[model samples]
Target chain A: MTGPGQMLRRPLNPYLAALVSAVVLIGTLALAIEQRAAILRDGREILLKTEPVDPRDLMRGDYVRLGYTDLSSIDETLVTGPWPDRDTTIPVWLTLAPGEDGAFVARSASFSRPETVAAEEVVLKSLPVRVTVAQPSGGLNAIGRLEFGIERYYVPEGEGLEIEKAQNQGRTTVAVRISPDGAPQIARLMIDGETLYEEPLY
Target chain B: MLRRYLSRELDQWTRSGLLAPGQAQVLLADHDRRYTGFSLSAVLAVLAAVLFGAAVIALIAANWEVIPRATRVIALLILLMAGLAAAAVAVRRGAPWVAEAALVFTLLCYGAGIALVAQMYHLSGDETGFMLTWAVGALVVSFAFASAMAAAGAGLLGFGYLLAVQDLFSGSGTNPQDLSSYATVLALAFAVGVAAWRSRSAIAGHLSALLLISWVMWVIFETTELEPGYVLAALGAVAFGAGSFTPSPLTGTISRHGAVSAYGAVMLLSGLGLIQVSLVDPGLGVEMALAAFILVVSVAVLAVAGGENRLVRRFAYFAFACETLYVVGETLGSLLGSFGFLFLGGVALAVMAFAVTKIEKRFKKGEARP
Candidate 1:
């Protein structure tokens, strides 16, 4: 019981209270930021020559699901090997060698050696690099509220919902990086090969 | 004394017209006058038997569709009738033993009905409808019979319903098990409290507070690798913090449990988040900043606001120390690691051991003195 004597004995520290609340707010924000950076820095990957499909969600808004090319034959543990630079299936940059058909294909990954015995056909397996993206413009053209950790990007729900409407009538194809999570929760959203919606879970 | 308290609370019902003033007067007089030859403990035992019997049997009945539906329905109705008769006898007599037995039997009837419904609807996984159904019946019985046990059963049923909704319906994004679940459960608990408070039953108030605290601790201390239950953790922290200041034993117990839980959960979550952040994306300066802020503020508030309350102060102190250690460890990972993580772990174990010993000694000495 807080007796009258005890209640009147002390005053609380305002600076401490403010500091704690500030810390909670800042911590929440920073955790958010670090998560974004992880999505940007490590959680994303490039899938060359892929397709996009619009998916509808009854819960948690709406978005698109991206289907990327399959990666078979991975070392499972990429800590050391020819792809020594590879870490978790997180994203990095990769340059695609294009063909006349506009379908860019590659013989090997950026991390593969050029100094090996002889040059042979290398069908682009796994690229140990991040893919550079084209940024879009205008509120009319932007994807909004994109989430879900699909490799390259998760379709933003706002724009994703809108696109889901359009794509229900049609389908679009775009290159995407698929996370090892069976599906990337949401790395970023893409539109017409442009990086639009993006985020990373730390 | 109990009669007077009950009359005061019962007055509200009379005013609200749920009971006639005459009926209220009669009930109050009867409660004061009757001697059921049954002790309160015996009544409580009967009530427990009824609730447990009903819940268990209902769960059994849930799978009893192989029997004819008509037969099942008939059996359920029979159970309900028996329960109602038992309740009538208990109410008319005003004996705690009979009241408890009646309440338990009624609960059994409720449970049987729940089973039949589950069987009928083939309700798999989601237990909300069952709990909701039971809660409504229990509520009616509690008010009609003025049974605290009935109120408690209803509260538990309602709490279960909340848990089911969150567990069965949470989405893929924005963790369902986070602060939202705790919020929902707490709201339900508060409603139960109000119901109990209106009854002016100490038993009701005590039970409500006890359950509320447990839920608070559960919310605050959940630290699975699942990552995001922390939102609940924050809400729980606030809830428990508020709870600690209340002048109720039920609330006090919850506060102590919740404070310790929140402290432990934050420790685990922070460390896990850090390791994950580093492994996935190293050098996360902002993550550190955010974690630090949450730690410093929560500890400070508990400490400064809590003042001389030994339990609250002790919990706050622990949180402060733990978070400080986190910062220190993160800042001096190399130094700690050079001595080895195992070595640090050993030191932690030793410190804990010493603290435990000192606490026991103090407790023993205090007891001896008294």
Candidate 2:
């Protein structure tokens, strides 16, 4: 090993540099794989209700923008506790319960995790989203919006339009695998209880 | 090119009995033995490596769903290991270009693997997250290998990360006034600039400079009510003044060059011109004043650094020429006035050309005296 200045003066050992490069590449791949495998193996399964909007990502290709009914459009009615009235990069926990159609819906949402949980209730977590309360209506029941990271369902190219069309007819549902840590992964896209696409955990 | 010119001069010197034939041959040999540029084989080897890397990425993006997830991961691991092993052998064989290119392929595989895993696992991340990961990986590789190509990649990825951050942070439905994300971009630009400087890659350094300047302008626009064009003009003026007139404390800490002065002069002139265009009501008086200031600055920069700094000279010439055309476009209200200005401009240019020729002769005579 050399001093940082001396390292710049002379060329690095190619073998060592190459070895470090290989370790980083393999390490990233392994970490991603292990993370996904944990979710797929030990995570609980739940059915999330979603409506689709057409969108495209340049790198990941086309996707049916998954607009979760419970998470995408959180209102004052769903929130059980005091909502944050300023900009925050904090996760809000939503306790989930089975709705009329046996699909999971938000029973109570809070900026902090609820201490008590019912026997049949599950909790889903959101990624860090900025929550801002409008100035005039900064009250307990202020109608504020929430954004969750589990918003997009990437599909193969040219398959988004069909999903959106089916979603328009109220025939689409998302099967999500919630990790033990409350992180949700989109597992499958179901149209009329038939599996359209099942995601592979790499 | 330098070697050829010097070799010819040495031949003439030898013929004129300024040096012996042995000394001329020795000088030519010394010059020829020095490693000045990459060989054709080295260039082609790097090109081949880049093409192969692109192919690997495309193969992964094809998303062979039929393959088991474990199998795809294993395959990528194997490819990554193989690339490193081959690079190691290339290093031993003294093929530095091949070694560097293999490292590039390894880095590309790392990115493709990350994207593939995200796609397979249905991970909820945006382009910003993806770009940050890729850029950090490239930067680490750049540092480890001291690779110029990797440094360039890191610089480009840093820019992509900045753009993605802007897109992701702004339209997140909440916190529309969150300008704090710019701090992350500033930090990224500084790191990439350091990597570029460490690699001694001029192209990456230029890209990083552009990134830093753009970030400054963005911060000025977001935080203050000042017009960015005017602020940029003032910034460029300060940078040029500092680099040219003041002794840089960075002379011992880092390399110093006259290029900073040239870069600053270009930015100052361009920013000033842009500010004029951004003016809402630039009246005739203001327009004429602006025109005069631009002309004076252009000439002053040309006279100050025109001999040593080619970039400054070129930008000054461009600004001067463009301002002259702009003045003609603005003052040409009547046909008679247009003809009169055209005649005046012609005479002025002729006199300027005579002065330039005289200066050129003086410079040549001064050089001949040495």
Candidate 3:
């Protein structure tokens, strides 16, 4: 045992161990909470129409699985900039604008963040999606899938099916707040233009 | 088990006049004192903590609506703090086992708290991220308290993170383009190695070694079109060389557990077995050559470290027997049909049994001398 590990064999003072553990654990939790809270408080808000499915998570209870309209699968022609060389997941910048139903829809996308967009359009960052198929005509024809990290709306046990039903009927929409970095956080859940649950900044 | 065996052996030795009656009691007492850290009470305490932690996690998963989300968060935080406080108190009272159990409880609470918050805020993160965060928390605890249990926990969680990222279990090889994922796992494994060393946990040390081996295998499979069996064999040869030939001081810590030699033997045998299976229609020449190579390697391993290392010796004997049977089946079975194959197999095994008896005697003699 005579090695670097040997050098570290002396246990920390019990009180010191306790203090350090508290600070690290508490700080991590607080940071996670604050990051989401900041986005909820100060980021741009937009409502997007969604289709929901239901699934139960072992650790996180029942939840509605959401698929945003026109966001999960974007037209390849809308992609601007050079595509990745290999089939791998890469973040794409999506520019969103209000559609006829007042829910935001993706207008265009790019491999890199757009330098500018129309005054009414807001740019949102997409979770990394695998580029599955590329067209010879300088556009991505198909991607594995896109995610915004707002796909799942955790709900009380056994209640996810109701929201899933509403969403499948084209009646459910999600209000999401996009931080400056293009990360989107769920701000509220809505059904038929009425807020069902509003998130509180903790 | 060790204590029981030692107790029985001590009594037998005393009765046989190998030790005086009172000397046996002194020896038993010394053994008990030295191994108190790993007593049954400690194991039971840790098990109880694990059960309690699981209950807390289940409560969070139930998403109990009676308590508001914010209140639930506060309660979890309080629980985590209280667990840490208890660990400190246990340490102060000189109850190391209780302190370790408390630390394990707190780490579990931290993970459950993460799950609870993720659920409450509707955060859509993958399992890899969740496991990585939990592992990092466990690492912090390990370092803070110098707790071996916490280090082992971190190692397990790190393994979970690796599993979540790669479909390794599905037998679909890793995505070659995702080198970053493997690198991250390697880094985490290295961190676990350091933590294991710091905490002096043999279990964690073994885990870290296995993790590194797994990463190498993943990379080899991903990056190369060549036979993974051959690659693994070469790697194992190198490891075996290092483990057996590396001079003391350099190999002191690693060889203390004889892990390197054992893992090397495992890889070597597994690689050879893979080659044997992969050769679906190999000509007689190739099959015989592979069998000879396998037999040679097994013997070499046995001759090198088998005298001292029981694990390596067992693996060597297993590999030798399997390769012998395989060669017999492949060559003689094809020529003579089932009846002759059975006769030849029995004769070969009987001969092998005689040789193994001799080898075992030699090994015992070597042990006795040392």
Q: Give the per-residue Cα lDDT of candidate 2 at B132.
A: 82
Per-model TM-score, in order, reads 0.39, 0.83, 0.90
lDDT of each: 0.47, 0.74, 0.83
The fnat scores of all predictions, in order, read 0.00, 0.51, 0.64
> Candidate 2 or 3, higher TM-score?
3
Give the TM-score comparing model 3 with the true structure, all chains together: 0.90
**lDDT per residue (tens digit) for residues B43-143 in model 3:** 99999999989999999988788899899889999999999999999989988899999998999999998898788778784677789889999999988
Residue lDDT tens for model 2, B180-278: 567767877887787787777787788788889888876666556788778877888877776666566765432232777777798889888998788
Q: What is the TM-score of chain A in candidate 2?
A: 0.81
Question: Of the candidates shown, which would achieve the greatest lDDT relative to the real structure?
Answer: 3
CAPRI-style grade of the A/B interface in model 2: acceptable
Residue B232 C-alpha lDDT in model 1: 43
> What order do you get sorting by lDDT, best first?
3, 2, 1
Better of 2 and 3 by lDDT: 3
User: Per-residue lDDT of A151-178 in model 3, one digit per residue for the tens?
Assistant: 7887878887778778878898899998
